[model samples]
Target: MNISAIDLTIFVFYCLLIMFVGLFVSRTKKGTEKDSKDYFLAGRGLAWWAIGASIIASNISAEQFVGMSGSGYAIGLAMATYEWIAALGLIIVAKFFIPIFLEKKIFTMPQFLEERFDKRVKTVMAIFWLAVFIFINLTSILYLGALTIEKIMGFPMIFGIIGLAIFAGIYSIYGGLKAVALTDVIQVIFLVGGGLITTYIALNLLGEGDGAIQGFSNLYTKTQDKFHLILDKSHPGYKDLPGISVIIGGLWVANLYYWGCNQYIIQRALAAKSVEEAQKGMIFAGFIKLFIPLLVVIPGIAAFALEAPLSKSDEAYPWLLSNLLPVGVKGVAFAALTAAIVSSLASMMNSISTIFTLDIYKPYLRKKANETELVRTGRWASFVSLIIAIAIAPLLSGLDQAFQYIQEFTGFISPGALSIFLAGFFYKRATANGALLAAIGSFVFSGLLKYIQPELPWMDRMGIVFIFCCLTIVISALIEKKGVSEKSINITFDLFKTTKSFNIAACIIIIILAAFYTIWW
Candidate 1:
């Protein structure tokens, strides 16, 4: 891969601009200092646009660029169900979930658990989340980002891993969520602009001097087998996608857990200026999610159509960037890839610190710690977590498909966590004991099912495990003989009402998704 001087200059300028914006926005008055609220929640002052941009920036990372592209190459358009279903999930979160979280003033997911259940449940889940974030989420992001650097830049993996950690840490550790969120606005601009450029180039190449539209037409003609939205049982990829289960089954568990309940993703909305702003931000994100597959997935399918000379599926994205793009455009596309990687790393680091400092350290280790002390502890936690992830990241090499690996591993926790939250919100009889049991049972049942039914698809396993978790909560509550716990949240119709504009936007999103599935199916 040959780099032009102009490309290098553009990449360097983009990096410098992001750092400057991050530091500039986070700078406070000369006499005042940042407290826990300012540092962790962006001073509770993020606007709708900032919230929307931050959510997409944080969510679309190396995983989508490198990992999901790999899945697209192997599994084709069926892989896009994750992105399409998530658009609907965001709407559900905005309409039903955000209001309760805002009304409760919830700063972290574990904090919500503490209020709804008990400290014991909160502590257990917080520790579980800490382990998952550091080991699975952070490590995978670092590994995939490093994979991209190694593939595109021809650098060694260790250099890429350490370099990205230092880059994300420079501003994110000191400036906190404020810096991370504000800088993401710029990152999204580069991300979308550069991503579209790469896709356009790939399409034009496929069309052989015809425009992108003709390129897509050629693609459909050549690889129509790769464009199905649903994979039937006979399909080679059915074990991963599992036919219609993608629509009416376990994918819902995955989407709701990731979009509505995950700490890092939901943290953006939680920091909004008001619940209205948060809801609007979520809807904005939903609209953006509608076309994300174009930026990430299509390039891989194009590579597959061209019969790219690749050793493995994960290399499809890097191969496209390296072989397809012209001189100056490569830098912009590279920066877009880097933007996705670093933003996600920064967001994950901030979230790891938030969970550890607030839910774990503040409650048990440092009950008397002041606000400044808590903020200091958070910064240290972020640094330490990054170091741990860097050390463990290289172990993820040789994975056939990194995106599927992440989804399957994270599924271990999503079922129980979603069950607990839904129970707390609607089922008044749910008790703290039941929440704890559901949390523990999620892992136990998933493991047992995997061992007992080794051939079952992971998606169906997740759906089955989710049902077991729901029953675990219910049975535990019935055994206790408590009618309704004192901590149960009182549900009201007013909590979920949406404005006319939001309703219209929601209808539009649903109609568009329906059209896509109908055409693809």
Candidate 2:
């Protein structure tokens, strides 16, 4: 992992560029008192391109680069269903989910729940989101990022985690969503560009100087057995992904929860100038997502072909970069990895701050807080959240299959949350009581199933729990005498109108998805 002078120079320049973009975005045109919108939602001024790039950059992090690549090493191309399915999920969110969220002009997902259901529902959801973001999402990203840095640069795990926290919090705490979104554009450039370069180099090496095309051919020739997109139940990795269910069942639950319900990811779209801009931006993100597997997963497959001696699958990507990438390129690849980790860290920190200040602190602690005070609270919240994440990150050491760890643990809540949101959006009869029951009941049931049905795949378990949640809510709503009222009507079907551009882009994405599934099936 010895970087040459050229490699170190490239890495330093990338760091400086990120710092410059983040700082520049944070500075206001004049010394004016910042409002909540300016700090939390980017003043609702983000355009389609900025929204698109920020969505992808915020979504792509050490999870995709480190955890996903590790899964690719173990499970091969089958692991790519997460990325490909997510592309479809983004399109679905744009067409069906974003319209209502934007029309409501809400800052957090829990806020929408409160409007649609009750204060109880909003408080329950907001608390749940805050805990998961702090304990799970933030902690996981920092751990994976630290793990990657430790492997690549030989930095100690604690130092790596703290350094990433400081780097991310520096700009994000001051600038908030605007800074995060604008700087994310540059982060995406470094991440995607550097990722592509690493994949190209790895493929070129695999091809023995023939070129990337030949290298790809060599990759398939060497590891054709690893190319299955669907796995049978007998396959060792089938329980993790579970074959056609990926297309028709629980994977959709996972994707919808992530793309549609997740606050940090959807916050970018919510900040768009218009619903049309938001839809188009999400579609753009979908298109970008289609290529993520190529950038992150392909390198792992190449690593397998090169037969690098790694102790674990998660080490595959770092091993490939350290062993195969030339001196100058290694620095670029390292920058790309750092870019992915730090940008995601920044995004999550901002989201945690947004949720705490708006959903929890404003409503509970200081109901009459002014705009300036709200912004200040958000900054403090971001800093405090980062400190907690940095403290917990190192405890994730020695966790095997870190990607699966995240997905499985998150499932406990995703099934219930997804059920409540879908029912609230589509079913007028879905009552507050029912929504609360769905949230609490489904989480408890999902957790119980982990022990009761230990043999079932997590995807299958999620699907089953979701069905129960929907049933519980529907039954409870039927039993209750209260009818749907105007007070709870924040969403309208009329808001789901689409542009010609959206339709055309969606059709193209569906066609591509169908072609991939068909070819691989």
Candidate 3:
């Protein structure tokens, strides 16, 4: 784990460069009032490239670098279903979800809900999202990031956690979404390039200096049994991925909720210059997602082929970096890991601030708050959420499988919330009462099933929960005598002229995804 002078210098420069870029972008607009739109949504001026880069940077964190690699070490290629399936999810979101959101001019996901339903629905969902961002998303990122830093750089866990918080907050707290998105352009480059380097070196080692091809062949030959795209009950990891359910079952529930409905992921698209720009950005993100498995998952398979002597699967990533990567390259890899960690932290912090300030604070606490007051409140919210997350992050150390831990726990609300959004989008008779009932009922039902039917696969449980939520909403609507005459947001399916570029890119992504599944199936 010893870092050479060159590597340490490179890492320091990377950190300094990121901070400089973020700060520079924050100060770019001189005459503008740091209003709610500018601070929360980047003044709604982000281009397609910025939106696309930010989405990938924010999405890839310790969860993918540390957690998914850990899962790859344990469960093999089956762990990558999350990434591969997400490409398709992005396509769906770009086509169906983003257009609606952009048309409504909503800042937060809860705002969209409120527009379609009522203020009560918005408040309830905002509170739920705020809690998830702080507790589940932020805590997991910090915990796993710290775990990686502790193993590779030899820092104590607490220092690593606090260090990451400060590093991300320095640029994000003041600049808000604009700074986060701008800086993400730099982060995505470091993260992906560094991740690719780590994968290449690890594979090269496995190939005995025969190159990536030989390494990949060696990897497949050694761990052929572990490369299944789908898992049956006979496989030990079946409970985690399950069989065809990964494709047509609960995986869709998770993917749609995440790529389509999650505030942080969708926030970028919402901020795009136009609906067309947003769609293009999402399609661009879908393409980036196609290569994520190579950068994040393959190294774990290489580690397994090498039979790394680690007590925990999460340790596989750090073990590889600590042992295999050379001096200067090691620093770059470390920086990439740090970039992945910090970018997500920044994104989540911005999202937490956005939801709380716009959705909760401005609406209920300060009904007549001005632009300056709202921006001030948002900055405060970001700091407060960071403090809470820092306090709770260390507690997640008890969880062994951090990747699956995140997926399973978040499943509690995803299906229910997704049901509400879907019903609101497609059904005019979907009453506020029905949406609320579905949200609350599915949450409670998901929890009860977790306790009583823990034997069921979590993904399958999600599929069941989504259907139940939909049914509940439909029945509630019928009982309340809410007819199709109730006018919801007017969704013009004919508004967008689907661009040929988007169509071609989407086809390429689908073909690549299909090829992977077909080869591995």
Candidate 4:
């Protein structure tokens, strides 16, 4: 809990670097969207590389740097399921969802639902998703950020949380999505670099212990139940992860909904300069995810070997950094860790502003608003959300199983949303009725599986619900008459130009990250 002078210097330098990057981006950012398209969707011209970097920055937060690593300490390799399984969804999104969203020129995922289904369905989904996004994202972020702050300077969790919110709000409100994207590129670099250093340091520390094979073997033996590839029905540890069945079957639906249909994550890709850039961004992120276990999970295993127990599991990652990282490098590591959290908060705040402005405000209240006015409104929205989130930060302080719970609770909407999107594209017969039905159906089923029969194989049960939801959509769509016409939609077709070079780089990175595990571990 005691942060040395070394830690303070490292954290401060990192903060200055992030502030520099955020300020630099704000200087050239143009507020003239010309319309909702430019301001909200970044003129539908985002290149794949920027989009890919943004994706990495958006998804890899303290959640990975802290929560995932903490999970690694407690539960071992089962935690890898979070990143590894997501590759399946990322591929589906790039291949299918991208083309559809581009064709629709849609600004929000809810818009696609409205186009494919109805306003009623879209509204239901939008409200649910927005609430889920605000709640889950902020809850996990606040806990992680607060812990990171606590690790640095004790006392005043409230002050620390507000400080982070204010800093995040600054870039998000002024620069909009561009600010978030630009900052993300820098944060991802620091995050990756910081994670690698910490991991390498841990690996060296492990080497000092019994030796690599003996050290890992000893760590594995103690944490064996946690590391087992298979899920145990009665294990108290996996309370956060879906049952094995969920991992195998239902998790795909959740990941697809998130990476593919979720407005917050996908909006970055939509901002790409072109389709190639967007694709490159996505494939690039896939590669980064491949390395997460090495940097995040394995370090947890190492921390366990060090018997580095903390009052909160989330503290494990930070504790490792505090103990293992040397003086000069520690500052960089702390900054990178904090940057990961800041990037995530900034990204979510910006995306929420876009949805509220374009999806909610423009559509209902200010339909005739000009680009400048809308941009101004977006700034206000971001600022307001920040204030609101800051106020709620203290209330979010007591989350148990924080990371796992965030993912689990969000499952209510994620699976349903995933089903709706998949149903929209693959099944021409999918009707508004079916779309509406699938959302309700998946919600009910996933909930019952999660809460009612607590002992049921949740992962598998959730997967079954997904299959049933798919069936319901297919059957209901077939029975209906009037359906959506893709022609009437003004979706952003030809959005991102897929990139071969980026894709190749992405693949090589994934291979390299995986090789890190196979060879080193």
| lDDT per model vs. reference | 0.93, 0.89, 0.91, 0.72
C-alpha TM-scores of all predictions: 0.99, 0.98, 0.98, 0.88
Best candidate (score: TM-score): 1
Which ten-residue region of model 1 has the weakest summed lDDT? 1-10
lDDT tens digits, residue span 303-360, model 1: 9998999898999998988888888899999999999999999999999999999999
**How high is the lDDT of residue 330 in model 2?**
91
- The collision pairs in model 3 are none
lDDT of 3: 0.91
User: lDDT tens digits, residues 299-353, model 3?
Assistant: 8888888889988888889888899999899999999999999999999999999
Model 2 score (lDDT): 0.89
When summed lDDT is taken over every stretch of 10 residues in candidate 4, the lowest stretch is 487-496
Q: Name the TM-score of candidate 2.
A: 0.98
Residue-level lDDT of model 2, residues 198-313, one tens digit each, is 89998888888789999999999999877889999877889998989999999999899999999989999989999999998999999998899998888888888888788888
Residue 307 lDDT (model 2): 89
What's model 4's lDDT at 265? Answer: 92
- Could you tell me the TM-score of candidate 1? 0.99
**Clash totals in order:** 0, 0, 0, 33
